[model samples]
Target: MLRELRWLMAGALATTLAACSPGDTELLAPRATARAPGRATTQQENLQAFARVYGYVRWFHPTDAASRTDWRALAAIGVAQVRDAATLDELRTRLVELFGPLAPRLDLWIDGESTPAPGPTPQGRDTMVYWQHEGYVGTRLSLYAPPYGQVRVNAEGPHRRRFTQAPAPDARVEVELVPGLHLRLPTVLSPADAEHDGEAPLDDAGLAHAARSASGYHDLDVRQGAVIEVWNVFRHFYPYQDTVEIDWPGLLAQALADAENDRTVDDTAATLWTLVHALQDGHGMVGHREIAARGRLPVRVEMVDGVPTVTGTDDPSHFAIGDVIEAVDGVALAPRVAHLADRLSGSPQWRRFRAASWESLTGPRDAAATVKLRRGRRALEVDAHFNASEPAQPPRPPQLHRFDDGTYYVDLTRAQYEDLEPALPEIAAAPAVVFDMRGYPSNTHKILAHLLREEENADWMHVPQVLAPDGHIVGWDPIGWHVRPAEPHVQGKLTFLIDAEAISYAESILGYVEAHDLGTLVGTPSAGANGDIVRVDTLGGFFVIFTGMKVTRHDGSRFHVEGVQPKVAAAPTLAGLAAGRDEVLEAGLANARTP
Candidate 1:
């Protein structure tokens, strides 16, 4: 089962501004080592390292794919890169080259009024240096082989600290405390998102969540670079906002008018969610709380040639596939979609590109009245009951089944935790458990904890970094998590399942299982949103969330947006919800059933 986590880390101007004085050896690295590590690690090491970092960049980087997959494909390129490198320094060079090539594709993902002029990088240097949050730079770690790598933070920091344990073959310890300060979102304040500028006329630091020095993976401190990444996501502001001037009420008014005029609450939510995602703060988000209790449309629809076409859903009586939607209750489809497109297009956050995030704009829209549809070109109206939505929660509950063939399956959401609980004993009776966490957990920590408990420890949780509003750094120290903390379940052998829906906290759950050898993962990578997600209200009532931390595995793999990969990858097929049909689930079951 999962633990409910709600601890906040404390941040102060002193802690955020500087972790330690130069007199002490602050966990950072000293000057140059060998320029090249010609005999460091293997090619797999390089590939895995680069691949992991690249995955983290998927959510954090500000560019798009070479095609409409602008973000995905660009992130995928990191795979080929690590496979080709011979040494650590070479890895760094390869990354520079890889990102450099993406300069032209920049506009494909960048959100701005006009494309900037063609020019060399801002530094005028041959090598392209990445702008992480704060003053952090993406550079090489001499400790590894050539084609040097990224994310080895031991190079230089506010102070120098030494390692007590031996370094791994691929490990090059380094750290650097970035200069300047990070811009915390308005959520940390009492009014929460009062100003458009992160620091709008707020004199009291007590009201906000302050940025503080990081309590790293083990003993490392890479906090500043994290804030830097959070600050410039999607290039909301370049060079950094020297001064703060946020328009609270104005932004809220715009968001509401934009959302209500569009017709569907889902559309509006996606627009705001896109903006929060741009910031890349894991904590930033917008979701409806009603999807769990309220019934879902039996009809599944997708936009085809700018029209709503039925895809699939649980409801059998609704309609057949390929049926075009004419209207909802009494509303028409074409006009509504057109208007929605316009409203979404008007928002700078959602319009800058085309991708999964962009493509999802048309789905699960709220229907105030019955919807009308054109099935197979025949006009028909489908009544979809709708209501005013609440806030975001995990996913809705899933259907579960236990086959006499020694297999178990479930489609779970937060609401279904109780119903699912009574069936656990039956599930455990199966020869193998095919645990599916393809997405975020519906419940905060109930169902997960029930099925997977062998032991529980407090170490699994996080140390909150409490902050004040107004962008002032505050000083606070670290301790292990105070809440649902670390408690590992060493019970039954498990095989986890996933798809695109598996993301963020769910990904973290997957990682925990993988790291401890609890089970074998089978599926595609998850939605890597495993940071401290903060949901803050805007000036009036608008709310937004963004990714916050730069979380890497204890071993250094990244998970910003790129998901976790399964141990045995399933070949994609056309099986629709059948047990013997889906390769991903079958593979997971096979792995679970194995000795």
Candidate 2:
């Protein structure tokens, strides 16, 4: 009944509000109340049910995705969840059960510290609602960092900003899991507050200085942290063939210093992010894993021809549509986008990734924003309105191409497994096969399950874990798991078409193809931002991804961060895409023709 109710609420909310603007102030229509929680859910008793899933993934979870947790990660998840929730009661009960009582991580002292503080009452009498599960977490980013700092966040893939709220902050926000059920940490100061508390925010010049300092240590690679170490250690029993040099002692020292810094958590987070970014790998990352984890502005928007166009907001009473968005907070989106594009341009196959990632955020991708706009040369403040986009048109679904030489090329999307799986036996009869796994799995687990299982797995089980800077693996278990598919297709010379985008579960796909010898893996080194991949549900600027475990591969090793390397590599470019060239696929085809 409890499970059903949870689903009912989630589904009801989704279905009821899918088309409604998140900024809409219309109260959700109330229904006949279920029996009071004390009478109904109270009987089902167990504090575990109400807590955020972070703890489950921290200790008992398996895969090396959500690498580790420091105070920021722990506190962020707790506060972030309640902030995203739809009701205050649900927030209160959940908070009480988690930080108040059933806190799995008791050492952080969350249970006692998360007590109620007074706030304005319904009638403005100044009494706080002790439990507000839903309303507490809803897009109001109750957490964030100082300005001018960066954060190192690891995720399996990028997220879509079509349906949620604005972003929290541009400053760094570092997080990682530690061993044990540690208690919650307190919310520290954001930039404005931090500066008020005698902390100075880093500026562009400061970033350059910090970057230079970190370069003496490790080049800033986004995929440098989180589950990467676990993958490095477990996947190869110490990869790199030689003893890779890591600042183990330095890592431990830093984690402690970060947690107790006088500079403030947000400032500290920003500093850590700068260091992580210095690693200089596409896969390496340092920032919020989930969009809902932070605060955001009030605007709805979309990118039109590389320009931010505001469409709507909750209170158009302040700012509305037709405004051209130029900046967020104080940072210009165009400059950031340009900077990222410049960084991406240096990659071996810059064109494809640059194009894909850029287009991913460009025109027509639904956007909600709080912004500074310039329309007809007049600057204005506006909240952009958003609407779901029609499915992107250019990457037209591929049609299967059958070659007369017993080689078959079946166009595949990560989600289109059922389309090709049934024809696998026919494919096995062929001499060569190609699987294009350039994207993450889109279909629910059912299709992926069928393609991956060698023997039908009755119970779907996988674990998610985070590796700390010191290399300790922390874990969690996702609650809902589907059955694994029992059948796997031909073990022939399969060549997979991968790019920077194939990360997380998609990166795990590389392990499966390589380990099972389903084919010769071909592509560039992945973007490497693997782990408990975050996704679209984040309300504010928080990248709220799937903070749970994913279905793993055979050896129980599901390291997502460092990404799978291509057996042969090719990089893409904007110029190349315009010419209708797929260098990676061509190279893959060349690799497959080994006579």
What TM-score does each of the candidates earn? 0.41, 0.38
lDDT of 1 by residue, 309-391 (tens): 54444444655555666755555655665554343321221221112122322324454456565554366665544332321
The alpha-carbon deviation from the true structure for residue 44 of candidate 2, after best TM-score superposition, in angstroms, is 42
Task: Give the top-scoring candidate (lDDT).
Answer: 1
List candidate 1 stretches off by more than 4 Å. 1-275, 281-283, 286-315, 320-400, 410-429, 442-493, 547-551, 554-556, 570-587, 590-595
Best by TM-score: 1
Q: What's the distance in Å from true for residue 84, model 2?
A: 29
**Tens-digit lDDT string for candidate 2 (207-318):** 2232223221121211122122212222211111122244533432343233233233233333343323323233333333321133333443333345544433444565
Whole-model lDDT per candidate: 0.37, 0.36
Q: Ten consecutive residues with minimal summed lDDT in candidate 2?
A: 127-136
Per-model RMSD to reference: 20.6, 22.3
